[model samples]
Target: MSKATFAGGCFWCIEAAFSSLEGVNQAISGYCGGETDTPSYDAVCSGKTGHAEVVQIDFDDAIISYQDLLTIFFTLHDATQLNRQGNDIGTQYRSAIFYHDTEQQQQAQGYIDALTQDAVFDAPIVTQVTPIDTFHSAEDYHQGYYQQNPSQGYCSMVISPKFNKFKAKFGHKMKP
Candidate 1:
C-alpha cells in the first residue's frame, strides 16, 4: 500500500472524497503543513498554526494509481482559489499535497503543470506540493466525521452534496 496526503478544503470533505475508494485502506483526518508539532482543530482554525486541514490516505497502488488520485484531487476542489475553498476561508482550507517522496512531488507538480498548459481553469492552480511533515492526528471526533455524523449540519448540507457529485463522476473508481 502507498499513501497520499492532501488538503483541498475541510478535512471532513476531503476525507469523505477518498475514504471509500476502491484501493483506499485507511483514511485519516489530520493536520499538516504546520509550524507546530501537534495542533488542535481550534488552533489550526485560528490560522496561527499555519496548518492546512489534511487527509492522509493509504491505498493499494495496484488498484489505483497515484496519477489517478491526483486527477481526483484537482477535480474535488477549486485549486485556483488560494487559501480557501468556497466559504471556508483560511490557510487551513488551502489546496495542498503533502508528498511523501520526490516522485510524489514530481508527479503533483507535473499534474499541475499540465493543467496550467491545458488551461483547466481561468485562474492558476495554487495547490502547494510540500513534503510530508509531522502529521498530527486530529481529535478523535474528527476521524470519519462524515460517516459517523452524516446528519450533522455541515455533513448533511455541505459534504453530502459534494460527495454525491464526486461519486457520480468517479463511481467507476470506487469500491462496491
Candidate 2:
C-alpha cells in the first residue's frame, strides 16, 4: 500500500470524498504541515498550530495510481480558493498536498503546472505542495464522521453536497 495526504478544506469533507474510492484502504482525518507536535483538533482549528486539516489516505497502488487520486482530489475541491473552501476560512482549511515521496512531490507539482498551463481555472491554483510531516490523527469522533453523522447539519449542509458531487463524478471508482 502507498500513502498520500492532502488538505483542501475541512478534513471531514476530504475524508468522506476519498474513503469510498476503490483501492483506498482508509482515509484518516488528521493534521499536517505544522510546527507543533501532536496537534489537537481544537488547537488546529484555531489555526494556531499552522497545521492544515488533512486526510492521510492508505491505498493499493496496483489498483489506483497516485495521479488518479490527485485527479479526484482536484475535482473535489476548488484549488483556486485561498485559505478557505465554501464558508470555512483559515490556514487550516488551505489547499495543500503533503507528499510522501519525491515521486509524489513531482506528480503534484506537475499536475499543478499542467493545470496552470492549460488554464484550468480562472484564478490561479494556490495549492501548497509540501513534504509530508507528522500526521496527527483527529479525535475518534471525527473519524468516519460523514458516515456516522449523515444527518448532522454540517454533514448534510456542507459535506454531503461535496460528497455527492464526488460520487457523481467518480462513481465507477467506488467500492462495491
lDDT of each: 0.93, 0.94
User: Cα RMSD to native, each candidate?
Assistant: 0.8, 0.7
Top-scoring candidate (lDDT): 2
Per-residue lDDT value at 75 in model 2: 92
The residue ranges of model 1 lying beyond 4 angstroms of the native Cα positions read none
On a 0 to 1 TM-score scale, where does candidate 1 land against the true structure?
A: 0.97
Candidate 1 residue pairs that clash: none
Best by TM-score: 2
Per-residue lDDT tens digits for candidate 2, residues 1-176, read 99999999999998998999999999999989988988998898898999999999999999989999999999989999999998999999999999999999999999999999999999999999989888899999999999999999999999988998888899999998
